[model samples]
Target: MDEPARRGRLPLPHRGIAFGGDYNPEQWPRETWAQDARLMREAGVDLVAVNVFGWAEIERSPGVYSFEELDSVMDLLHEHGIAVNLGTGTSTPPPWLTTAHPEVLPVTREGETVSPGGRQAWCPSSPVVREHALRLVRATAERYGDHPALALWHVSNELGCHNALCYCDESASAFRRWLERRYGTADALNAAWGTSFWSQRYGSFDEVLPPRLTASAENPTQLLDFRRFSSDELLEWYRAEAQVLRASTTTPVTTNFMVTAHIDTQDYWSWAPDMDVVANDHYLDHRLDDPWAELAFAADATRGLAGGAPWMLMEASHGAVNWQPRNLAKAPGELERMVLTHVARGADAVCFFQWRASRAGAERFHSALLPHAGTDSEQWRATLRLGALLDALDEVVGTRPTSDVAVVFDWQAWWAVDAGGHPTQDVRYLDEVHAMHAALRRAGVGVDVVSPDTDLSGYRLVVVPTLYLVSDEAARSVERFVVGGGHLLVTYFSGIVDENDHVRLGGYPGAFREVLGARSDEFFPLDDGESVALDDGGVGRVWTERLEPRGATVRARFTDGPVAGGAAVTRHEHGRGAAWYVATRLGTGGRDALVTDVLEGAGVRPVLPGAGGDVDVVRRDGDAGSYLFVVNHGDDAFVARAPGVDLVTGRRADAHEVPAGGVAVVREQPTGRRRPSEEAPA
Candidate 1:
């Protein structure tokens, strides 16, 4: 593929993790801009994300659009030598558009209509919404298409609006178009929705109703279909703007997604294909965040998606934000350590929310390179330390993560689980996915988190927990991988349904019966706090469906219970590989043990082991060799026995371990085609 085939590239200035932060000059004066630039120079900040929330100022009330202020800001930034992550600034609706067309008002889940009160408050499904958003996108691209100061395009602002989407008129129509394309016929729709059961079969397209909270969700399939519709609708929205940038501009494009919060916004699997590079926002309430578990998997998953493409730490914090109860300052060197973790995981650049904190707005209390207290604050000092580090290692920005072993998780499946209103409300995909991730780290496995749609043949093994929707295509990909001797592990709920959210009624595991070897007839739900003990005596909440397997050998089953004999876990062999299934939500111990068994069965391990549980390990897949990131997330001393050159010191590990809360990036031996430089990120 040519560079800028779909998403353009943010030409790399160098390597070793780009250091930068979001710069909202619209929030402050030009004098503050110089000071911000000075602080950035001190912190080694190289890129600034401009125009994320500037729609009101840039296109002041439609026809009266003016870029004079933005022109000056861009000119000054160019003079400062800081590359720019340009934004189209379509997140918040400019008051003029909303006031003129109130139909763009976003609808709530319960049908509680909203008046635009905050950023991202506009309806995504509204035609008027899409129309205006596109105008801004096109306008921005036309005006700044080949600006020399540009680094990349940060399309829309943070992208997800807490999953509250447009339930307005236009979205409903768009949802129908998507359904028509996917199902082809009303009969197919009826079958997919099992509409006959509820006497809800539609006679015509117009009769097709949305799965609103008050409407279609009466059936599980209805709810699932709605979830699919909503996600696809948003995907279309992102794609439309992406198409705009791809057609009119030379810069790579991406919108920042919130880190694995509700529904995995900018979910790498769903959205990465559209990104020139991936960018995400990461923040926590200070006290403690299992940085490795929660954020690492998200990052690895994204890196894996763009086929190991480079990504940026688009947004981070200079200090604690106003949201947390204790807006604690990031003590001294805390910022540097956090940035290192992101780089070790595979971030090409780093930037905070505000270049300088908002002087007087909602985010006035938010952390930034420059703060409300002005020039000489503790937060400002931390920014300086970060800048110094970025300056020292200016050669590795816009680099990719080199990895192996793509762990398969799917949004379709995730959506199914969520909308299925699973018999158990406690079934959590992120938690289960994280458990496996934690186990891989413990065993020192170079883990690459991925989705079912992601390419699997590159890795030796692919593990998918509760792959409820193994679309035929995704199933074929897995089959092809296994046929070629790649390992496959598919857990309970392996098949269940198809892409349209319809159950695979012929038997269980609709699409993957042969590959997984398990046929589930009926599985009963187990409520929270209740569990079937593993054969090893470890117990946990049996989140959903007690398994009844046929053809597959039981690996683990609910012990000491009425459903004890039912297959709670099973394994089967196919072609040159094997697949396994877990029927219950095992506690951490059981989950870890189960994952260990699977990885061991696949014959994969981290190049270096025995670094202890606190050292979070991840492998970034790239061209010639991969970069292994070993992060010490625990409180005690974490001794990381480095596998290759410690990228941090340009030296190998002298001792067999690193100190507590330390990190190491090791170079993995090369294999396969040297990955070519591509515009899109993994």
Candidate 2:
């Protein structure tokens, strides 16, 4: 449990599945505030995040604070029976502060200073930025600490959304200080970074610098450490602000984590422990091959960060977002399906980016609960419908979803595996992770995405994908998990490097070679659009390896390619459980087949065994009973065989018909047997 949770400062202390979004009254006229509050009540909104980017509006000049408008906004929200998730308004620095202390501006890798026109333009490691931001936090907390509307203290908008990495002189100095604390001595830092390579050894921590723009690929360890340092610097800044908030009020404090597909700078596993309640901002990126699958993966990952506790869906889009190339609006019923999906995955609160659309700003076209078209619009209607559904399923407030399968996700591995100098750039960290997760989803299995260091004793099956970097302790824990009766499926390019970005030197996949009962000496990265045939009639792409199994039995072999007749996939019985290894990127069919086989061996079944791949079924258990959420993301409806009262429709039936691109929540009865199947309409 986090500090606030331990101190009984539970987030949303008196709410049931809170519903609302970022409400920026500052952006509207004072006359519109009352109307907004009225509409909020009509929409069933009980919570609103206020002043996310109000640093400049609150603190016009240095230390000169104004809370009259904010005071009115809070009072209005309280009067309307809505709670406030108050932001410290330090997301962006005022133009005056940036102009006066231009040194606090973040410098890019190319030595270009990020201008103050955008949010989060200040360097996280700069003392000037930290001091001013904390002052703002203190002042905000002091004024509104005892306010009735203050339910939670939102630290900064998104901690490292824009300025995660800064290459300025102040950042360099801070990085050295962080290094001294991490490695203790320059000699240790030299050894860990392998600074002897290419005559780049550092004599002291002072000589170390952030991995700046280099001619060729910079030192991989240096790049890895710089990424680590950058994440830590931002986390330190969050801690500083959170400390100020904690001193003022008993309200729980948290910041929205960017746990989406694109943003990867912050190591959220490290940041999760500091938050009172884990909240994530997930925006679907349509650019991916499988955006919905990625959404499921991200939600599972966020639940893992929350330690299986119910979390908050801090920011999502009602329809469309301004960012992303060719921003597209959500199809009819997509908003409800997406929101219910998050709720089913254990998000107690469902909120969007903003309550009202921005008429003029960088994200002017971004979707909101109340779009420019207002209440008559499809977006607003859908928002109101979702709010009602949330209110109906209020029984799911403190419940958690359970999953028997676990996927190991490490940000350090993500940083190191995707760094320069890898054999094939095609082996992306999330690609393999998402592919594995999608395969499981297709098999109708629930998944929990956890860090490499997480406990694996409770899981029946554990999947590791492209984990190129891992510490010895984490590797040993995984080994223990396999040896002590936990099924494991490891994919290509995993277990290659140590924590210091150094290869284990004996063989490829050096960390788990013994446990996997396999050894690989070489890699054969295929060309673009290249695929190799497997002996079992499955196709592999992007990567292939020369493998020799010692104790493991070959399940499939490469029939053609540079490494013909080699083991394409192998399985070994090591102690109490079995370990499977895939030496190449298997296509969807092959990966799904392999995953199904592993789940069968481990005796792990999906929430609804025979449900179609497009139908997602998840169950949450609470005092109210088990709530089975069936989401059909296909063109046809799905009939789920479970006896319960449908929360959405208020009907009690043995089987619920989840419509196409729709959702159904069933509060299950205790006396019915569930026959998991997807029966099409006659």
Q: Which candidate is the best by lDDT?
A: 2
lDDT for predicted candidate 2 compared with the true structure: 0.88
Candidate 2, residues 1-682: lDDT per residue as tens digits?
3454532213784468889999988888999999999999999999999998898899999999999999999999999999999999989999999999999999999999899897888999989888888888889999999999999889888888899999999999999998999999999999998988999998988898898898887999889999999999989988999899889788888899998889899999999989888899998889999889999999999999988887889999988888889899999888888998898898988888899998988999999999999999878888888888889988778767877789999989999988868898888888999999989988887788999999999888899999989889988998899899888999999999999999998887789898899999999999889999998889999999999998999999999998999999999999898899999999999998898898888878778756748998888866546888888999998998888899999999999888899889998897443322121111
Q: Where is model 2 poorest over a 10-residue stretch in terms of lDDT?
A: 673-682
Tell me the lDDT of model 1 at 473. 89
Worst 10 residues of 1 by lDDT: 673-682
For residue 508, model 1's alpha carbon misses the true position, in angstroms, by 3.9
Candidate 1's displacement at residue 314, Å, is 1.4
Writing each residue's lDDT as its tens digit, candidate 1 over 1-682 gives 2445422223555344566777777766667777776667667777888888889988887756688878887877788777788888887888888899987887765677787666777777888878888988888888888888876887777666554455666667877887788789888888777778868887766677666676444766656666666766677778888889889776777778665534443334666766667677776434434544666676666566555556677777878788666787775446766776666666667778867777687778888777777666776676675676665544444445554466777765676676645556666566566666666666666567776766677776687777777678888888888878777766556667777666777677678777777666666667656666767666756543545555668776666565765676788777887777776667777767777787667766554456536666655554345665666666766555444566656676544355566655665444443322121122
Total backbone collisions for each predicted model: 35, 0
Regions of model 1 farther than 4 Å from truth: 1-10, 14-16, 162-164, 215-217, 243-248, 264-270, 285-291, 323-334, 395-400, 506-513, 543-553, 565-567, 619-628, 643-653, 666-682
TM-score of each: 0.88, 0.97
Backbone-clash count (model 1): 35
Instruction: Give residue 530's lDDT in candidate 1 (0 to 100).
Output: 63
